[model samples]
Target: MPSRWIATFDEPALVAQALTALADLGVPGTRLVSPAPYRAVHLTGQPGPWRAMGWLVLGGGLCGLATAIALEVGTSLAHPMHVGGQPVIAWVQFGVIMFEMTMLGAGLTNFLAMIVLGAWSRRQVAKAARDGLRSDRLTLAIPTSGRSPEQLQAIRAALVGATGIEEAP
Candidate 1:
């Protein structure tokens, strides 16, 4: 038996209907591939890692800010260059370094988070592309590896009007 089933549909309505039907069948790992985003199809799943990413970025920025403060204050105190009645540690001048470090930290954290979180979707989209998915059509990939014969038959019945049905690679 194939590991997965692929169904292609030209009409958005059919794809939407097929998605709902698959959901009703309790099919897991059902993915939709479309040339453009469709308003009709709603994806309901766990919230993405974006919230965690935001927190991570905030932490990274705070760490960077702390590092910058330490560097500026420590170096100033250690060197102790009292220039023309100015204080040993100048808080106003440290703003540039603090801002730069904070931005650097947040940007790096954001990049790493994006790479890690986006990998799975990237692989799925690449698989869809390799399967001859077209820009003018919508494709649905349904995992069928653990499904019983009857369940497979029911899935096929649900997608009766699909333009094409094939075993996904």
Candidate 2:
């Protein structure tokens, strides 16, 4: 049920226009990949790291703090062994474990976050499609499992207004 058909354009302006039109038409899973970055065709309407990633980072930080506090409290209370002239609850030494745990939490958060977002998933060649556009050319892709005849015709017409149209099977 996964397939892609790229709609090509010669200018970035046309790419953006068609993208906006298609999006307004309620097309889902649309993408635009071009040699040059086109600001207008961006569909996600979100910039920078996703909100979910921010939540992951915040949660990881809190978990790291909690672990560090638990370790420091439990260790100090159970076995109070003084080192040099410092008290048994010496924060200087405890800072090492805190730092290490914080780093570990952050690393694990990033790894898990990537996995959750399917960032590392392999691209199936069968579902991949492309439209040849020049470096100066702008393009868009509408990923669909089943496109209606009317929808396909509309997409073709919208793209044709810019440069040319090509659909992949």
Candidate 3:
């Protein structure tokens, strides 16, 4: 009773057509699996989560930069270092440290968000789809969680019309 179904098509163009037809029916979570990279067969209808992640990365970088500046300034003030009457907060000397910390914060935040938010677990590769994907076939996976029997029939009809091989539920 898995809540997913797949339809394999022979041509990439057919896959695109099927995707459009399914989208018209208001299908939400659809995926395309192909033997090679094909630009024509995009299936996901949801707005991607990358934009939010980019904001998070930017925040992390800013926090890291602030932390780096504070550390340098605080240490210099705690232990008076008057090297040739240089300012306590030497931006030039600490620029590399700030850059390094910024990168570290962004990297760590990206990794943690991917793991915790389940962004890394987006796609599930079935064995059948994997085999076909390595060959010369394209598969469209549609989530059938709350569809009616009539909707299912329409989906099957669309797949058959697109010269798809079989429907697996």
Best by TM-score: 1
List ranges where model 1 is wrong by over 4 Å.
Answer: 11-14, 34-51, 83-85, 120-134
Model 3 TM-score? 0.68
Where does candidate 2 have its weakest 10-residue lDDT segment? 120-129
* lDDT tens digits by residue: candidate 1, 50-145: 668889889888888888999999999889998878788878778899999998888888888888877744565438534655777888778889
What candidate 2 gets wrong by more than 4 Å, as runs, is 1-4, 9-13, 34-41, 44-49, 70-79, 91-100, 120-126, 130-139, 143-151, 160-164
How displaced is residue 86 in candidate 1, in Å? 3.7
Q: Please say which candidate is ahead in TM-score: 1 or 3.
A: 1
Highest lDDT model number: 1
Expressed as tens digits, the lDDT of each residue in 1-169 for candidate 3 is: 4576767777877787788788888787777777776764445554556558888888888888888888888888899787877787788988999999989888888888777665344445444554556466778777777788999878766665444544455
- Compute the lDDT for candidate 2: 0.65
For every model in order, what is the number of clashing pairs? 0, 0, 0
lDDT of each: 0.78, 0.65, 0.72
Local accuracy of candidate 2 as per-residue lDDT tens digits, 1-169: 3365666667777677777777677776666656765676365243334457878877886788679979897878899877787888777888888888887787788778877664432132223333353577655667655878787767666555565444555
